[model samples]
Target: MKRPDCPSSSHLSSTTPNAGRTWEEIVADKQRTDAAKIPPEWVLPPAVVAGAEARRSLVGAFIEGLLDAETCRITDMDVPDLVGLMESGAFTAVQVTTAFCRRAAVVHQLTRNMLEIGFNNALKRAAELDDYFRAHNKLIGPLHGIPFTLKDQFHIKGLETCMAFVGWIGTFEGNKGTGKEREFESEIIKEFHRLGAIPIGKASCSPETSNNILGYLWSPHNQQLSSGGSSGGEAVMQALKGSAFGVGTDIGGSVSMPASFNGVFSLKPSSGRISMKDVANTGPGQQIMPTVAGIMGRSVTTLRLVLKSLLSTEPWLQDPYVVPLPWRELEDCCPGKGLAKSKPTFGFMENDGIVIPHPPVQRALGLVKRALQEAGYETIDWGPPSNLESLQIHGHIARGDGCPDVWRALQLSGEPEVPQISGLFEPDGPRDPMSLPEYQDVVVHMRDYRNRYQEYWMSTAGLTKTGRPVDVFISPVTATAGLLPEKFFHAEYTNSTNVLDFPTVVIPVTFVDKDIDVGDPNFKPITETDAINMAAYDASAYHGAPAAVQVVGRRLSEEKVLAMAELVVEALSLCKAKGHGPSSVG
Candidate 1:
């Protein structure tokens, strides 16, 4: 599977060479080649791009105005409807591919969110899918002609994965002369190909790189705010409908936070639920708390379909680290799945006990709670092991090595550490790695916390009418309505999920309404962090940003979590009908 026409390095021209070039020269050349990939006709005028930058939001009318009617209609569709139309010949594969690529070109041009662009290769593959369907009178697979984006860490064929490190610009993960460069692909890429999903491009990865390649990627929903954690680029792409869905990696809130911030649905499955094989990573040796691939899309159904489609390929056979579990029909508690009569009772989180969520996040959590109660489902307060315990264990397990490898990657090209991640290292170099005994102590603490949490979860069976544990618990995805630079507060809820290895789904509930969601006059701080966090909440600063909640199921319970997420969505819809749910706009 050699990636033809995929240059290992972006050539300056027929006359120029890369030898002895400065890192600046290499970076400039890559950006030039990437922008050149978009068709000239699709490029927006400078004035339009400038106007978009000046605006507070890039979605809705501003972006839709740039696309033609047909492009708008095509790109607006979710994954399932796109596949159905492609299967029925109502739209050719090339049509859908071109629509998304056109919109993606606009997205990258406006936000600088693309690390690599592969529009030509994607169009060629879309034509091939159309050929297969014409010859066989059926879709090539369930995801036929669907376009998707990934965080730049994935090794997509026909795309160079620099992962935003300048030292990695012209090599296979910082090594030169490797024939596998740009030719190698991840396990999930192979599964996607088999299902006929096309890769349009790679999105920005990390470090809020306004100074680097994908310049200043921020929230598409509200440009005033930070997009989110590391998965911000992919989340913005989904928010703007650049593709049908997207894939990202999350160790803590990397995926969930951005999805929540941008107002989209995301599933961060427990490690081993999805394939992570051959993906580039910063801490490759950190397996005690393994990283997981997360899916972000327009709806819970799309997330479920994407995961189930991957599982159908039996990914466990290739990636042994992936669990051997297939999609469990019995576990899906969707309507008509025979569990309707026994609707799942939900656990509700008023607060995580360390830091309180912002007014908007608090409202989102309460809305979900009331929605469920109004829809005939039982809701109970959820209290488990303290998030502070998970916080300590997560730091050691995730970066106990002091992130020497991350520091080395930056030093490879002398790229200064961005302010976002500068805290991970000392002024001069990485911190000392934890000793074996100390690291083991953290692992032991993690196990104990997990055991206690599980005991508390199981004990809920005693409090329910059905005498069963609450199916899944819902809580704030983050403490803020949207992430703003230097305005950090709480991550206990998200960090604890990784520490406990639970499958969690982020459901976008509402947006920050400065008019309605004002700070509580009697709000009492529970900790120093809480006091500082609440003090920073200015209503005008956070207006119109998305607020969301996350649903957590027990470990490896993705099926149940997703189904329960669908139920939450349905319950919200029920409340909306009753005029007691989310507002139409912030």
Candidate 2:
């Protein structure tokens, strides 16, 4: 299969002339048009918007306070429930789609996370699905009539995918006559449409989740903290219940970090599990550590539903990059079927021996450990190969080209680099690209690192009483519960998974409690990065932010990873019931 081009949107306007407009004007016009796309009935009053801005958190009660009971009831339902309701004729596709579109519109107005709005188009598609259901008297597919949003990297027939770049707003990836603007769609988009899912909008993403188009996306759980970047907009949408689920891309912790910070569930499958053909990306030349698409939802079941449905379409037939493996129900079973009759053992890594997680994160890990122990699972201390190696390999491979393409994209629209990514380039232009030999040397190092890591994992069989390696391992999703502007220090927890191509899941555990998650005043630093990361932790500032942990499995083991994540969720629930879990607050 031929890989399609993943270009950005053109900077054109229907209301204003495309030419003779400043970059600022173009950006402003797009924002205005996007806001205008929301239905008048769905628009929030200025007072409501002001009120939401003033609040510290907009999740749960705060967001529900702004919606009618019907809207709340409809939007709160997960994908399975929504599908069941539609299939039983309890709700029409238009009704479900409209409720989410209205809520998404409100979410955008308050949070400014939306880059392209397709409310009208989404409703039209919903109506078409309803008509098809009426004519055939059967559902379209597993995801029929379910509404979703994605990071702006994806292309939808009527949606603009600029990925937050101002120069590519109206044209096809900054070109004037490409003729693919709003006409071409990504492979995943096509698959979702066939599965009966509707695309409602696209989200803004940047290095730290803030962007030129939508400003900084704050976590709805705590407005003071960041939602997380590159996929933060989608995370915010999911946290706000703006859509049933969402899609985001991750190269290094982009999807997992935001999902962690925003307090939602996410599955970052290994590369090739999902199709990324024709998706807009920055490091297209760096195929060695290619970006992979990830799914974010309120529940693991929703994530499973999406991945399973996509595989049913045989995505590899259209995108050679997608693995031919279909969803394996047998692989999802735990401690069952043709294997060990004994209880499963888990590998636990409290810290990377470099940077320790913040207090809330530490508490969250403790909760998981205690819960699993109470549930009769053996937990082992996990000491993998140094993340320092993954860090070196990741930095070299991810930016070996010096990001000239990113620099060129910004130049096309004259938009100043967002503060989050300004350090990537020099004063005037990109730095020198690495030589071929140097790049190859790093690649060899990466291979050797993967080998050593796998060997270390397999060697655990000698330590376990069952004579089997750990079923899965658990660790912090990041060094902090929620990001505080530019205070991010470590990515190895997530970056290692990317280097090894391991499938991972992010499960929200508890909220950050300032009184309990206080910093250790007498702590000693293990490394320079460790000291810098720990010093940036502010319990009072991160109060009420969500804290989460990551569960990792070997490469292409999405089913097992997701199943283990569900196990973690169940264990946490059991702990909470017994008052041993982390505190819960709205």
Candidate 3:
């Protein structure tokens, strides 16, 4: 009955020399190693580090104040601007790489977000890129010399991918004597390398965005709030402008939630758009709803550039799981599109009816709706299939196997499970896995749910004045602007997209304001989960945290989704210019 990937019961009793060490010691040693990777010149002073620790926010002027003029100039540019600057000979690859590495070093020291640091090697590679540019008198690719980071699940040459598991630290995903340690690379890394994007480091991931390796990652906008995970660290890095762009993996709301909480943009494409080959994951056998890679960046354009660049590599040639679709150039879904003379219609879902969003999130949705209407786009109220279906199917499909591999990985070093995931296993061991028949039934249920949802979407054509389906839908990224540890209730907003295999883009709108965003005095709960979720919302605690909305398109419509997201951004910008946007606090 033992699964091939799960560790045997005998292996649980067999402990390595490190088994005697406390988990705290293992984590501390790893932290020290990451800190030492930063060069002496890039290290922050004791006073500056102390100040940052004492501050509530490190984003905007705070983090930028620590950098020199050149570093500030280089780090502030988006991916396209960075590449254009390098190609124009106005800035060399080394300059851009060093600026981001230095800023990332500062971010790691303050937030403990980085799991592995590869700055020295990154600079060396930047030098080689500069040499190539000098010799050829042209750039290498669309992403030439743009520095970036990844979630720790990715394998990069010379870097270890522990994925926040203490037991997996020194070894390759918990196995020793594997020549592949620091020698092998993930398929996406190869694609990024070919595109000339530099990998500066790897970040931490866990539920609630905390792990033993890097501790908890907090929002740069409001340090009191959690950076939502399991892609929290990547979001924190993007918020601080540590890199031009970063990559993270998302199954549920991992990428979208963090990006929302951190005031950044992210694209969580449907499965198969991006490759997951050779990547380490806890639920490796969950193929029905596989985890897809997502891109986090400072702007919609940056996200578009990263995805388009990756598709240019034809990843399907190397990773069989990847779709063979190339980047399709689509006209903006604006007024000029050839589909119809009328402007695009938007399907707006303010809440799922089960769990209502917090006031800040509601305000964000209102702002987006008004902005779109003011910009000549029609908005329709959207009511898709209930997310209760996704809620049931997500658990069975994502962790139906009882997560024996996760328990086995923790057993490697005898490290205690972080509190966030401790409930996954019984005191003795992992819970019993579901039977094959039951699991298949849930899969069938999931397929039926997706079909019904699509049918509902198709039915919208009858509701819209344009006589066509809405271009894309808008909704809250999460129930709250920022997460308070252990306060998360429902994830259906983002989880439904995963279940339906829909492409989504997160667009930051405004920040939480305790002065204005308060609970409605006459509000009544629709369900038990809604009451619990609303009771957890503390406007005072969530103040200054970013609130965002997501633009969701049908499956395999990343290009159209990004374009529509840009439209959302444009609408919001115009709204803010006219002083009609939601009030934001620093």
Structural similarity to truth (TM-score) of each candidate: 0.95, 0.95, 0.95
For residues 491-562, write the lDDT of model 3, one tens digit per residue.
Answer: 999999999999999998888889889889888999999999999988888888899999999999999899
Task: Judge candidate 2 at residue 405 and give its lDDT.
Answer: 88
Q: Each candidate: what lDDT?
A: 0.86, 0.87, 0.87
Regions more than 4 Å wrong, model 3: 1-21, 332-342, 582-586
**Candidate 1 displacement at residue 242 in angstroms:** 0.2
Residue 74 CA error for candidate 3 (Å)?
Answer: 0.9
- Tens digit per residue, CA lDDT, model 1, 321-367: 99899999743367533334566789988788889989999999888
Consecutive 10-residue window with the lowest summed lDDT within model 3: 1-10
Clashing pairs in model 1, backbone N/Cα/C closer than 3 A = none
lDDT for model 2, on a 0 to 1 scale?
Answer: 0.87
Backbone atom clashes (below 3 Å) for every candidate: 0, 10, 0
Candidate ranking under lDDT, highest first, comes to: 3, 2, 1
Candidate 2 lDDT over 131-221, as tens digits, reads: 9999998899999999999999999998777988887898787787898999989999999999999999988798877666667778887
Q: Could you give the C-alpha RMSD of every candidate to the true structure, in order shown? A: 5.6, 5.6, 5.3
